[model samples]
Target chain A: MGLTKSEIFSTEQNQLAQLLKALAHPARIAILQELMKSNTCICGDLVEELGLAQATISQHLKELKNAGLIQGTIEGVSVCYCINPSTWEMLEKETSGFFSSFKPAINCC
Target chain B: MGLTKSEIFSTEQNQLAQLLKALAHPARIAILQELMKSNTCICGDLVEELGLAQATISQHLKELKNAGLIQGTIEGVSVCYCINPSTWEMLEKETSGFFSSFKPAINCC
Candidate 1:
C-alpha cells in the first residue's frame, strides 16, 4: 500500500520482490502447498481443502495468478488451476541466486 | 495491516511468509544486495550507497534485523551491520524446500 520506490531497484530485484510479495501471506502459502501436493490441476477442491470461503480462496488464487505463480484453465464449467512451471523455475532460480549472493563472512559483527 | 489468518497455516509456512514479507520491498532487497556485496560488517555507508535518507535506510535495516536476516552491533559511535549466517542458511533451506515442494505436472491444466 505504501510507496515501494520500485523504480530505483534493478529489474531482477523488483521482480524478486514482486514474487515474494505474492507469497507473503499464509493463505497464499497454504494454497500453494495444496497445489503442490495435488500434483495436478485442482478444481473447486481448494475451498474444502483449505477450509476457507470460496471468495477468499479465489482472491488468493487471483494473487498467485497475477504473480505468474499459477495458471487456470476452463475445464467444462469449472476452472482448474495448477502451478506454472516456467514461472516456478524462474522463482526458484532467482531466489536461489539472491540467497547465494550472500557469502557468510568468517569474522564480522 | 489486515489480519493474515496465520493460525491456519503451519509454522513453517508462517515463518517463510514472514521472511518473504520482510523482503517484499525493493529498498530491503537493495540493502541486502549491498550487504552481500560488502561481505563484511558495514557501518554508515548504506545512506550514501542507496541515496536514501538515513532514517529510511535505518528503518529498512531494522526490518532486516527483525527478520533475523541481518544483525547489527555497536562499534564505537556507529552501528555495524552484517548478514546473519545462521538465519541466512535457515532462510535458504526453507525457501529451497518451499520451491522444491511444487513438482510441476506435465499434463492437464
Candidate 2:
C-alpha cells in the first residue's frame, strides 16, 4: 500500500515539522540570530555580520520568508528583513505545546 | 573570505539547529507523538501505531536516539523506548529562549 508522507500525520504535526525544517540549518540560525540581535530591521547587514555573502543570505532569507518565519520589504536602496511577529508567536505557542505534550508517568532510563 | 559554517556560529546556535534537524521530518514528529501518547515505554509498537515499516520506524528511532530526544532499553520480549527528559527540557528552554530573543520595536512587515 502506497501512502503519502503528509497524508498520515496530523496538521499540527506537519506544520511543526515544516517549521523545524526551515530552522534546521546552521546558516539559517546564524542569519536569524543576526536579525534578532539588531534593534531595527536589517538591510544588507547580514552579509557583514554573518560573514556570509549577500547571495547566500538572500537564499536563506527566501527560505525563511517561504516558511512565514521572516518578511522582507524594499526600502529606498536596500531590502529590510525582520521576523514575522504573528508567525513568531504561533511558532512559540506551537513549539511549546509540542514540548509540553508529553507527560511522563514513569521514567524508564 | 573563507569561513567554515560551524566555526562562525555560536555553540548554542549549532546545537539547537542540530536538534531541530533531528525533529524536522514528519515521520519523526509523528513517531514522537505516538510515543508520548503511550503511557509506558513502547516496545515494538511504533510500527503498528505509526503505520510505517519496521525499518522506517527503527531508522526514525535511531535518529531520535542520536539527538538524545529518546532512550531505548531492552525488555524481555522487545526493546522499549521513552523520551529523554533532560534533553527535552533543554530543547524546551533553548527553543523558548530563541523565540523570546526577538523584541520588535516597530513592525517592518
Candidate 3:
C-alpha cells in the first residue's frame, strides 16, 4: 500500500511481479483452474463449483477481471467469465522466461 | 491476515498460489533476477545491487527462502544465498502445467 519502489526495477520485472500478484490468491487460482477445466466461459457456475457465496465469488471475479487475466460480459441477467487470451499469453511468456532463465548450478553453503 | 479458506482448494492450487505470492513483489523479483544474473551464491551484494537497505533486502530474501524458492546457508558470519534446485523444479513444473493445460479454444465474450 505504501511506496512500492517499482520505478527502480525494469519494466519486465515490475510487470512480472504485477502479474504474479494478480494470481497469488488461492481463490483466484481455484477460479482459474475451474475455468481452464470447463474450457469455456462460465455463467454463475463458480459459486456452485467453489461452494462459496455469490458475493465472495463476485469479488474474486472482479479482481481477476481487473487484472485483465479474465474477461466478463453480461448475458441477459447473468455475467459470463473466461480467460483473457492476450493476458494469458503474457502470463505464460513472463513465467516461462523467469523460470527458464535461472540455472541451478550455483554451489553455495 | 484473516482466514485463507485454503481448505476448499486443492493442494496444488494452494501451493501454486503460495509460490506465486512469494514472488509477487518487485523487490523479490529483482532479488531473484540479481541472483540469477550473478550465477552464484550472493553474499551482501544484494544491498548494493538492489539499492535497497539491508533490512529491506533481508526481509525479501526471507520471504523467498520461506517459500523454498531460495535457500540461505550461513558461511562464517555472512549468509550465502542461492536458488533451491528442488523447489525451482517444483515451481517450474507447476507453472508449466498451469499454463500448458489451457486449451484456449473456448470462444466467448
Candidate 4:
C-alpha cells in the first residue's frame, strides 16, 4: 500500500515528522526566516521579498498555519502573519531531543 | 510550474529543507530512533523492530543515507548502518539557528 502507517509510531515521532513536513519546502523555510527576521507581523510583503507569486506564497502560508508553526490575523484588509512561539518552542525541543539521542560511540561501524 | 524554484532561496535554506524532507516521515524518525537506541550498527534487524516490510525499511534507510544522516557498510553478507555524526551535528546547529531566530516579541501580533 502507498499509505503512511502513522499508527505504528510514537506520538513524538509522528509529531516531529509532521513539523518537519511543514518545514520541508524551501519556500516555507524562507517565509519562516522572513517572519523571524522581521520580528513583527508581516502583512503583504512576502510576495516581493520571496519573488514568488502571491498564490504560491499563500499556499505555503496555509501549510505553515496548518502546521501551527505560524499564525495569521486579519489586520484591516490584509492578513498579517507571525511565528507561533509555542509551536516553535515545541519543535525546537523535540528536534533537539531527537538529535541529542545519537551520541557517537567509540569504535562503532 | 509545479517545480520547486530552489534558486530563489539561500543555500542554507535549501539545505535545511532537503534535510527536513529526508526526515519528514514517521517511519524514518522511528528508524533513526532505533539506530540511536541500539548505539551500534544495525543490520537486517529493522524490519522486525519496525514491523514494516523489509523493502519499506530499505527505502527509508536509503533516504536517510542519501541525506547524510546515516552511514552503512557491508559487513559479511549484510549491511550495517549507523548514524553519521557530522551531518547530525550540522543539522542540529542549523535547525537550532533557525528556531533561535524567532524571539517572541512583546506586543507583537
Error of 1 at B94 (Å): 1.0
State, as a TM-score between 0 and 1, how close model 1 is to the true structure: 0.95
Tens-place lDDT digits, model 4, residues B1-109: 7799999998988999999999999999998888888876786899998889999899999999999999999999999899999999999999988888778987677
Cα distance off (Å), candidate 2, residue B100:
1.2
Question: Tens digits of per-residue lDDT for model 3 on A48-105?
Answer: 9987789888998888888899998889998888898899988998899888998767
Query: Which tens-of-lDDT digit does each residue in B1-109 have in candidate 2?
Result: 5443887888988899999999998899887887888867776878888777898889889999999999998888799898988999999899999889888757554
Best by DockQ: 4
After superposing candidate 2 on the true structure, give the runs of residues whose Cα lies further than 4 Å from its correct spot.
A1-4, B1-4, B107-109
Model 4 scores a C-alpha lDDT of: 0.91
In model 3, which runs have C-alpha deviations exceeding 4 angstroms?
none
If the candidates were sorted by their TM-score against the true structure, best first, what order would they fall in?
A: 4, 1, 3, 2
> TM per model?
0.95, 0.92, 0.94, 0.97
Sort by DockQ, best first. 4, 1, 3, 2
Q: Model 1, A7-97: lDDT tens per residue?
A: 7778988898999999998888888888888876786899888777898899889999999999999989999998889999999999999
Each model's fnat? Answer: 0.84, 0.77, 0.83, 0.91
Number of colliding residue pairs in each model: 0, 0, 0, 0
Tell me the tens digit of each residue's lDDT in model 3 across B53-104: 8988998999999999998888898888888889988888988899888778
Q: Model 3 in CAPRI terms: which quality?
A: medium
| CA lDDT scores, all candidates in order | 0.87, 0.85, 0.87, 0.91
